[model samples]
Each structure stands twice: as C-alpha cells, then as structure tokens.
Target: MGVEITTHVLDSPRHRTSYLSAGPPDGPLMFFVHGFPGLGAMWRPQLDHFAERGWHCVAPDMRGYGGSSVPTGAAAYAVAEVVDDMVELHDALGGRAAVWVGHDWGSEVVWSMAVRHAERCRAVVSLTVPYIPGGLTLEHLTPLVDRSLYPVEVFPLGQWEYMQLAIDEPELVAEEFAADLEATFAVVFRGGDPMTLGTPSFTSIVRAQGGWFGPSRRAPKMDRDETVLSEELLDTLVRAYGKTGFLGPHRWYANAGEELRAGRPGPGDSRVRPPVLFVHASWDPACETVTSRLAEPMREACDDLTEVVIDAGHWVALEKPGDVNAGIADWLGKTLRTGPHPM
Candidate 1:
C-alpha cells in the first residue's frame, strides 16, 4: 500500500485548522491551499504526487471551508485574517520556510503571504491565477480586463461583475449554490471548451442575470464533468460544501479592498523575491492570461518568475493533473530543489 494521506487538526488559540498531510514528518514542506467551495481534498493529486517524492505535503481546509473554523461575518474572512490563520498553521508545522501552492482564491492567500510576509515561504506555485501583489480586488483587476472581449460600455466591470454578488446579496448567493449541491458542482466543474475562449464569461453578466442560474435560482441539471473530477473527489466536495454552505466562500469576494491594501510595499520589501511559477489556464475565460493583460502586473512584480500555459479550464490542476504536476515538479526541480532549497 502507498503512503496514506492523514488528516490532522490544530486547535490554536486563534482558530482550528483541519489539514490533509502526507510524506515523512521531517521532509521538506509543500503547503497546498484551495479556493472557494473547495476543501483540502481538492489537491489530492498534487498532495499525493509530492508526498511520494519525500516532500511533506499539507493541504489546509482554509478558514471557512471543510473542517476549519467557519467564523461569522464577511469581515472575518478578510485576506489578512486568512493569512494569519495560514501563518499560525505554518508555525505549528515546524516554522520552516516552505514552498506554498494555491489555486483560485487560494492564490490570493499565498500571494498575500509572499507580499505581506515573505519570511514564511521559500517559493510559490500558483494554478490558474497569477500573483497579483496588489491583491485580487476589482480596483486592481478591472482595468486589466480584455476590453475587446469585454467592452467597457457593455461590460463595465468586465467579467468581474459577479464579485458584486458578495456585496449586494450574500445570503442569496449562498442559498442558490447550496440549494442543490450535486447539480451546482456538475454545472461549475466542466472542462475547457475551446469555443468559449474569447467569448464573454458568464461572470461578466452575473449582475444583470441576478444570480448564477438566473431566475432558475439553482444550478441547472447536468452530468458531473468527469474530465475534471474523480467520483470519490466529487462526493467529498459535495459533503464538504453541504456541511459548510457557501457563505464563507462567497465572503472572500467581499474583502477585495482590504486584500488590495494589504499588498502594498512595507518597509524594505516591495517585489516578491521568492521563485514563483504561474500556471495559466489557457481556456479559462475569466482569467485569460494568454490573451488578456491580466498577467502583466504579475510579470512586473516578481523578480524571479516562471510561466507555463496549460490547455485546460479554471480547474487546470484537476482537469490536467499530470500536466500541472509536471509543470510544478519541473519548476521545483530546476529552480528550488536542485538549486537552493533542497529537499
């Protein structure tokens, strides 16, 4: 039998963190952080792969997800708050400078760590989302949207209009997504569709449409996208979201201002100095780094940056796990492991 991935919980004075861990306890640390409506289990592929190679892999159920403490109020889910939770967790796990990996909103958390406090991380690998040193706020992102694809007159906020859901109607957003877990997961987990490349993502019109499923109020019935999800993984996600609901995840969108403010230069640290590998989702309409200028800030902000374009959708890590793992392994082997931060 392979090395078993173990579940652990740290009850710190600040909060309770439930994380999945593998590899030898004394091995080099590789922390994996997930995004909205996700658990630490979402990173099972990367966690298992890295663990087998003598890297201690830890994927945490961030603040409001899975087995972690789900604090009430959107203010409690701010970027600074989540960053503190992670740093505390890091301290409990031996206080070593480890390589951190994140996807979607998790990218924001890791990036916040590097920008706000670089001492905790040796390197960072981001999937589908690039490092935005100034945070993921629309104020920092809307100007970077593809104007041709999302014209200002038509799409004033670009594909980020959905962010308003958190501000305008948080309960409704949570209620709708939690209304039917299976259909919601299936609807959102589809793999890339090349035909939808330059088209306006559904996110651009979320405000006008009212909700994710418009007047329907819940996800439309659809088959789970097996291309991106294993049956076991899918079931686990449903149960996690079922238990937590969507309030905590949706609250992440409400704290963009604080996140952006937290990323500004302090004291001597301005640019992110750690080795960064940004994995872009080529077919993701909302984050089209290949075509849009969405990745420009990241290019200018990082002193040491590596870029790889993966032919997949938003769920690049899940849909193309081999490619994602290969990209990170190549970067780590070439940049950190063999060069400086050896395992």
Candidate 2:
C-alpha cells in the first residue's frame, strides 16, 4: 500500500482499455495482463512489489473485461486484436520497451506481443500458461495433453474440454456462469490442490457433464477461498463480472479456432529471442506443464528460457504471491541485471 493505484483510460478508434497505474511515469515500464474473469487488480500484488523495486507498473482491464470496452462477437477477441490493444497501450505509454507479465489468456496476448512487436518488449514472464509459439489452438494444445492422466479412450478432450464447451455451447456456458456470478467467482478463485496431481482435472469432464455445472448450470455455493482472495478482492471481482457478465471473456475461447486460422505464423514468429521466464503452477491440473509435455513447445521456442515451478494452482499469483514475486525478482536479477542489487 505504499503507492496508490491510479486509473487511466486508453481510448482508440477500435476499442477502449482501462488500466491501473503506479510508480513513476518515466520509470522502466512493466505491464501486467490479467486473464479471463479477472481485472487489472488481479496483478495488484505484482504491481506493488515491482513498483517498490523502481519500475513503472500498470495492469490493464483487457478488452471485454472490467471497465474496458466489451465488444460483441467472438472474432473481436482474437489474439491479433488483443495484441493490437497491447501495442497501442505501449505506444500511449510513450513507446518504451518494457517487461511484460501475463497469466491465462493474458499470456497469449503477451506472447503475441513478443512475436508481433518484439521491439516493445524488453522481457516477458508468463504464469500458469506457457507460450505455445505456434499459437494455443485446441489443434496444437490437444496433442500435448497428458493421455496418461486423461486417457484418450475415456477423456478424449483431456483437460481442455472446457474450451470446447465455449465453442460448442457458448450460450449455455455463459448462462451457467451468469446464473450465479458470485458463486462462479467464489469457485474460480479457490487455492490450488496438490492432491489432484496426476488425476483428471475437472476441466477434462466439462463436455462429458454437458457443461461446467452440468444440468444445474450454476456454481455450487461456497465461502470465499481466502488463501487466494480476500473478501474485499473477491467482492471487487464479483462486482466487475456482475456488471460486465461472462460473455466477453468466454468469447476468447469461442475465437480459438479463428485465432489459430488467422494467426498462422511467419518465419520465426513462434520463437521468442528475448529473455523469457515461465512460471509453472505445479498444482494446476488443467494446465499441467510440470509433469506433462505442455511446456515443451515453450522450452524449444525460447532461446533464453528460465522455468520455475511454484507449488500452487492456476491462480498462482493470487494463491502464492510471495513465491511468485520472489521467483520473478530472482529471475529479473539474474537475467535482466538491472535490479537494485543487480548481479
């Protein structure tokens, strides 16, 4: 709470993105991108820590989230459009090359930024989701699924079946989340579970169950998971989703096929030459990269890759902020060599 976060809007002809900023306006920039069902506030912990370390920190409410413009149509949420948002935001911030950090769908955006606009990125860090280089389509992702935990015979779609839910039954999935927004947020922001390792993640069964909550179409009532979210933070997220609804976020998945089709890579587009750090959530059963082949593409694509495994779930930054911050700090010190006590 050393520096208060200030809100600013980047308005463009195509879309409007709202963001939270802290630290000096002219300091080296650090942009934090949040995933689906999350706001710029999700990166509060990272923002505060990095800002204290003398970096200009900003986290944007990506298009279709929070106060940002929620454009209709799934195609509007494609990676190219989201990357364009980042490029424009960087330009609005004075065109300084900055370190980029992302989680979930945000990772996809930053990865694209590194590829499509490398000059704007000094370094990149990804949480939970790794850079897929070729783009993270079901066609590219399904092959990397761990068949042992999710056997092809029974769980044909693996942990990514939920993605299919968005494609095949978008309205139903959206209705289920909107049925009880608070409950949905409560369920989504829970801490990770190590006990579920090597097991089929609930995501793998979404299609088999007909939907996220099956016939009920609503998340089960539960208390907020304090390990991952304080009551204040949870309430903030619930309110944001309540106002914006889940259709825009879910549109990310609906456009996966199109993102893949339109995102065909040029020579070297898949490879990231900048210093890259990928933080793997060890307990993330859905995006299980620690014990699966999911991270292989990232390993091969990045020439300066440094991988760290945190014993937390998909919401690693929220559930274990200390470790996440420490990992990033350590990586930045060693790799970037521009910290206060640079090596």
Candidate 3:
C-alpha cells in the first residue's frame, strides 16, 4: 500500500499540538500549518502528495484547534505563544530545520517562525497572507487597504471591518459562530467566486451590518461548496469545531494588539534570507494581494521570493489542489538539492 496518514499528539511544556503525519520517520521534515477555523486535516492533500514523494510531512492543528489543547484566555493565543508552540513541536519531532508551509493565519505563524526562530526553518511558504516584518495586524494592514474599493469615508476599516468585530467583540463573534456551527462552516468554507472580482468583498461590510451574518447575528444556512469543501472534509471540520468551539479560534484575533507589539521589527527584521514562495489567491478579495499594496512589504523584505497567482479564492488549496501541489513540487525541486528520501 501507499503512505498512510497517522495521527500523533505532541505535548510541549506549555501546550499540546495534535498533528497528522505521513512518510518515513527519517525523511526530510515538512511542517504544514493550518489557519483560523481550520484543523491540521485541512492539509490532507499536501500531506498525501508530499509523503508519496518521500518527504516526512506533518500538519498540526494549532492551539485551540482540533485535538490540540485550548488555553483558557485570549491572551494565550498571541503570536508569541503560537510561535512557541511551533518551535516546541519542531523540537519534539527530531528538531530538524524543516521546510515550513502555511495558509491564512498559519501563514502568519510561518512568518513569525522565520523571524523569531529562523534557526528551525529551512525555507518558508505562505498562501493567501504575506509576511509583514512589523507584523500582520491592523496597524500595518489598515494603511495598505485598497482605498478605492473601500473609500476611507464610508469604510474606515476596509475589508478588515470584521477584524475589528473580533477585537471589539470577540465573545459575540464566537458565540454567533458557535450558535450555529454547521451553517457557519458552510458559509465560511465556500470556494471563491470569480464574479466577485473588482467588487468589494463580503468582509468589507461586516462592521456596517453588525456581524458576519448581518442583523441576524448568525451564519446563514448555505450549501457546502463542493469545489472547496468535500463531504468528508465537511464532516471532519464540523466534528472538530463541535468539540473545540469557536472561542479558541476567535481568540486569535482578540490577542492581535499584544501579538503585533511583540512582533515589531528590530535590528534584522527587514531580511528573510531563506528562499520563499508566496501563492496569491487571485479571487480572495479580502486578503487581496494581486491588486493591492498588501504584498509590498513581503516583496521588499525577502532576498529570494517567488510569487504565483492562482485563479481561486481564499481557500486556494482546497479549491484547486492540483495547481497548488504542482506549484509546491516545482518550488521544492528548484529551491533545494535534497533527494526525495532520506537514504
């Protein structure tokens, strides 16, 4: 048979991270980090592909997700704490300087990992979100918002108005999402719509409408977008969210101020010397990098960076797995000189 995915739990001194692994134990390590409202299982496609190609691939459910430990307070979810978790997990898994890959909030963690613990990372890859040396928060993000799509007069927060909702009313956002988990997942997990190009993303109006689902204050019922969320994955997500609730995930935003302050640039912050790959989701308007200045900081900071544009939305990996895998495989081939297997 082929490589089989296996679940493994690693307990760090501070927290516990549950992860899925494939490939031989001694193979070159590759850590795949997931984002908000997502579990390690979200990287199933990547894990399978990389494992078959002779890489030891591991994807972890970050703190407050899946089988991972859920800390008591929002402050516990700060970037520093999250980075510590990744570092500790890396150590527990043989302490090799491994390739780090992330998407969305996971990308935020990879950016930090490359900075705070560069010794542990061989190379870094991010999808959807790019690195900001000063930190990826409202302070740095707000100035970069595409003002044309969101006129400062009417949309002060731009597409990130919902982020303010997370900051100002974390509990409310969590409660609303937890109130109707299935509907919430269905609404949140859809594939990108090409028709949304050039138009304001749905996120731009979160503040004006009072919440993700407007006055309803809950996620509206939606069919699972098969293009992005398959039934198996949907079932997996529903079960994961059911146990952990939205509190842990939403807390990620609640700790933004503290995280950003800690992440402010210092002496060597401007340089990320490792070969880097940034995959731009062309249809992800809210995290829109294709037409916005949001990616400029990442471009300026890195010495060797390659960019690819995928014709999918925010959930590019799930929406177009083949394209993503091809991009990554190509990158791995050109960037590193290692053989497929450890032998």
TM-score of each: 0.95, 0.96, 0.95
lDDT of 2: 0.86
- Tell me, what's the RMSD of every candidate? 1.9, 1.8, 1.9
Question: Candidate 2, which ten residues in sequence have the lowest lDDT sum?
Answer: 256-265
Evaluated at residue 70, the lDDT of candidate 1 is 93
lDDT of 3 at 174: 83
Residues 1-343, candidate 2, lDDT per residue (tens digit)? 4677899998999999999999878778899999977999998888888887778899999989999999987789887888888888899999988899999999988888887777888889999898786677887899998887888999777899899888888778888999987788888888999899878999988899898887898999998888998887887887888888888888888665343355456535567878899999999988899989999988888879899999999999999999999998888888766543321
Q: Model 1, range 1-343, lDDT digits (tens) per residue? A: 5568999999987799999999988988989999976889989888878888889899999998999999998898888889889989898999898899999999988888887778777888888787665678887788898888889999898998988766789889999999999999988888998999879999899888888899989999998789987788879988898889999888888886475555555434557888899999999988788988889988988989999999999999899999999888888888875523332
Which pairs of residues clash in candidate 1, taking residues 3 or more apart in a chain or in different chains?
none
Candidate 3 residues 1-343, lDDT tens each? 5469999998856888899999888888999999988999999888888888878899999998999999888789987788889888888889988999999899989887887677787789999999887776788789998888889998898988888888888777888888888888889988888899888888888878887887788888888898988888888988888888888888888665344464454636547878899999999978999989999999998888999999999999999999998998888788877644321
With a 3 Å backbone cut-off (N, CA, C), the pairs that clash in candidate 2 are: none
RMSD of 1: 1.9
Whole-model Cα lDDT of every candidate shown, in order: 0.86, 0.86, 0.86
What lDDT would candidate 1 get against the real structure? Answer: 0.86
